[model samples]
Target: MDRVRRAARRAMFAEKPAWQRWSLRVLMTLAWPVGAVTETLYYLSVLPPDEIPRRALAWADRGGDMLALAFSRNVPPREYYTYRLHQPDRRAWITACLYAPESYPLLSWLNRRNGADNNTVQDKSRFADLCRRHELPCIATLAVFRDGSQLWPATPFIPALPLLWVKDLSGSRGAGAARWRLDAGHYHNGDKQMTFSPEALARQWLPRDCLVQPCLDNHPALAALSDGTLVDFRVVTGIHRDGWVEVVATLGHLPCGGPSGRRYIVGAIDRNNHCLISPTLSGFQIIKNHPDTGAEITAQPVPFWPAALELVVNAHKKVPEFSRFVFLGWDVAITPEGPLLIETNSGWGAFNHQRGIGAPLGWTCFPDIVAEYLDFSEHGDAACD
Candidate 1:
């Protein structure tokens, strides 16, 4: 029963080291209040002052209860009224919390027994190996290092490759990710500079588990969109019980050259997964032209859209360990050859896609993922439609 599972989870959490439990509790306590205030402000911005109290009461009656409404901002009253009222009980509110980016620590802990290995997805070296084994088109690794020591039987660095990317195995948001050219090395973290070095590069810049891979010369079509910087498509997907893979949502992150170089420009995708319009940072200030090259990407066609979808769906099916992740965001690059796997993300941020877009998780696919999981927790039925 769901009650039994919750009790067991609480016991397991209590058994953890006191420091670890205390730290996690502190994080949840701190984040909950912030999320509550922020969500309240969001509702106030969109709703009438007099309607707020009525809406709050409705949310509580629907299973938000007192603690759920006060501690979590994953679901607002408006969203529940709009998209979740059809479901019985407060299932939708529970669903929102489980998938919220802020709840990752708790969700990962609860689902750890399901065999999700976030480190495998975080480490570029390990992820690259997974791609190679699956015969997926991916950036080839030239060398790998750990703690300042070179890994044996390396992939052989090519002196004439023109560009090499140095990455921290566990880095995110481009932290510690860098590009090395014949002239200078470019770090994505604040654009720091370093001279290229095969022997000492890892120690100097990386200083941790690191990997070197040849820079991908993106397909000409993709290059035109961002003036040659690698353009990554964030394709979020889910897998169903009947072995069907579904594309949940897709967005594009086009980096354009600024005075220094182009910063990340995020954009929503059209129905066909093409760039909808001039990409914008913060979902405002439409960029009609590239800052450096002045090329227009508004409504630009994304080459091989169908092939890319197939590749990602198949890639998801190949990794059983990843099955535990009900939702995942895959970073895919369009190359001259075809679609290439850049990286996989279990904890993808929703702000870029959902910030200005007023919709719940199920609006795109309408899959009752939370309902399916709840049934499984209470009835031991894992099958989902």
Candidate 2:
């Protein structure tokens, strides 16, 4: 019965014209509020009954203005705050309410402009070219291109490099990233062996245009935390009111160094932005030691923290097209030479930051942050909202 139902759905979907299918997707995206309500109910179901009223009061106190604003815009308050209730901290829910799409006009506008296909900063190949042209310190990335049915490597290779990371130019969260290693008489991608023939590889990896680069050797400070897995600092930066770029939040994600890759044991960065310590699973559980090696990560100093911040700031300034984004998430690797740019995220996720600190972002405290991004002054006194 399940197979028949699945086949029927697939046949129906395939019968639709491409334009019709795309239109349906767009409509579904626009109707996120409906799905948001369903999600909120699921979280509410898991909460303790005795503490519900107390948490509700806190939510009202912290997210009242934002919630009211959302309601006025025909967006339900629960639609915005639902998923956040799963967090141990009640503040996460309030923060989500404060930044809900209906109330935060700037978020909606930015989403329309730079979300999905519109965002170029997420393009790994394009970003590598930018870095090369600007002479910024970054890994040498070869952009793979497709010619007819054949895919070609961007640069000549000796077939003996120790390691390479093949990444989808438009992928994120390490989903499209794959590691290749030169082994005895054969090439290996993770555990699978690949044919040495270029044509074989091209046929194997369809829909070309990938960015290939040498695997980054972790700096000693980061390596100490998570053996060989690449540990990086996620730096959140935004344009400040005074017309200067500044770091808003910084955190570290240490991998457990196994098949469960990039699933980090999150840590809180110090006020100085130079050290990471007191690892936690998004404020849900305290992680005292590395899951793989049992090494302590608490109160560890990250080497060359100041330089990493400066490099990120310079990189952000070079991209004028991304200025409208206002907020960017940067994955930075601290190498022995200096800091290297791993990638930049326009639609950066908030799970790690919110979970790591277990606190609300500045949405409620500073309503002007959203106002400034929206250019509210030109829109005529958005102060009333």
Per-model C-alpha lDDT, please? 0.60, 0.58
Please provide, for model 1 over 272-382, each residue's C-alpha lDDT reduced to its tens digit, 9 standing for 90 to 100: 445544366535555676665667767578888788888889887777766666667889888888889888887666545553233344355524533333334344433
Model 1 alpha-carbon drift over 4 Å, by segment: 1-113, 152-160, 184-193, 196-207, 259-261, 356-358, 376-385
Residue pairs in collision within model 2:
282-355
Off by over 4 Å in 2: 1-41, 44-105, 111-119, 146-158, 192-207, 240-243, 260-262, 363-367, 375-385
Model 2, span 1-385: residue lDDT tens: 1121122122222335778855764775577556555544554455445435466666444354334433343334443343344335553454343233322333334434333233457677677777778877888754354433323353443345667677776777786777776656555776564545443443444566566677887887677677476788888776544446677667788876565453567765776646666577434456787777777777567887888888877776665554545667888888888789887886555545655544545432223444453333442433221
lDDT of 1: 0.60
- My TM-score estimates for the predictions, one after another, are 0.70, 0.70
Task: Quote the positional error of residue 365 for candidate 1 in Å.
Answer: 2.9
